[model samples]
Target: MSVTGERLKALREARGWTQEEVARRLNVSRAAVGHWERGKNEPSYDTLIRLARLYNTSTAYLIGETDDPSPLSAAQGRKRPRSVPPAGWGRLTDRQKEYVRRVTDEMREIMVKELLDGEQ
Candidate 1:
């Protein structure tokens, strides 16, 4: 198998996930996962990002750039940039604002973590 394929197989096996399980998580066909593991095909950029996220590793490691499988940004200890409140957020009542902001912040953190954790 190709280096990328070998790593992909190894990572999936390490996770104790079946090919069908990986495919289900990725919203792809089991055959597609097989193709990736066999090196008959390579995942797209976006798919690679998803795989790296699911595997808790870096695309750099998946694609054979670096051997270190730790996350790219977390390993570097980069600080998250401050996020601005959403537009029209001040129109809410004080209590409403607090509740909404908390939920918004939580959702934003998930999005930011996903974007930051995966290389574009």
Candidate 2:
């Protein structure tokens, strides 16, 4: 079987989720999930990224580029300079905005820690 298919199946099975459950999270049909796992088809780049997020893994891992599931460090992860109130941030409700802020802050902290750890 394809590496991508293997990883997808392994990750989903490891989470004890059925194809239907994964489909629900991906907003796709169960057949889509089955097709992906069976290597009958591949997800688009956008869907691959979404899958990585849903599985709490790195796109690299999903695509068989790496064994590590941890997301890229901030430097590698950031595709562009971060802007305050990033596009669409204003569209979120106040509570959602706060949640985004908290998550962003936590991610920053984790990035810093990773950087420090690498230096040691």
Candidate 3:
């Protein structure tokens, strides 16, 4: 595969995103991602920039000029929380957990309805 194709595949896999997921983020079809990875075609310059931004890397790194492609290199080798919880929410009792779950579900439904209605 070409350097561009190899780098694209590596970056996408590093982020644990499937081709379809990457395609959705880039507003392209999964086939386009597959083709790019397979070197059947190349993305335009604008798409290349979009890919780098989405993957949090530089365009030069995406094209395989540098091994350390991550834009977060400054924070590299530092320990960080696996998953940070929202502020103001400590560990919850069983009752509180249930209540929060219900409220979250209700809010999700309301937001989804609003979004779908707006689309129509």
Candidate 4:
């Protein structure tokens, strides 16, 4: 089995869940779960996030990007994955969003400076 498929199956089995059960919980088809576990297809980005959350693991781990199983929340104070915007972002005012963008840019600059300093 592929790394992702193996990981997915292991996580679900570790939870003592059937593929059908996982499908029901994720609001997807049982065949979809089967496809994932069999490595026939991959889940979409949003579905991948939901799957990671459901399995209580990180997408990086699930996708073989990292061995770390730590959730994104464990990286507190770290910038969130750009694909997943901050909560309630859509509800924010345009001016508030702009302010947030500026803050994020400032934080990125600070992080870059810190990394450079550490290297020196």
Candidate 1 regions with alpha-carbon error over 4 angstroms: 74-120
- Poorly placed runs, candidate 4 (over 4 Å): 74-120
Cα error of candidate 4 at position 96, Å: 36
Error of 2 at 110 (Å): 19
Candidate 2 lDDT tens digits, 8-65: 9999999999999999998999999999999788776668778878888876577554
Instruction: Tell me the lDDT of model 1 at 9.
Output: 96
Candidates sorted by TM-score, best first: 1, 4, 2, 3
> Model 1, 1-120: lDDT tens per residue?
655688899999998999999999999999999999998987876687789889988665776545678876644753333475444546655854554445435545665887777976
Error of 3 at 1 (Å): 0.8
Clashes of 1: 0
> Which pairs clash inside model 1?
none
Cα error of candidate 2 at position 34, Å: 0.5
Off by over 4 Å in 3: 72-120
TM per prediction: 0.63, 0.61, 0.56, 0.61
The residue-level lDDT of candidate 3 at 39 comes to 74
Model 1, position 32, has a per-residue lDDT of 95
Model 4: how far residue 32 lies from native, Å: 0.6
lDDT of each: 0.73, 0.74, 0.68, 0.74
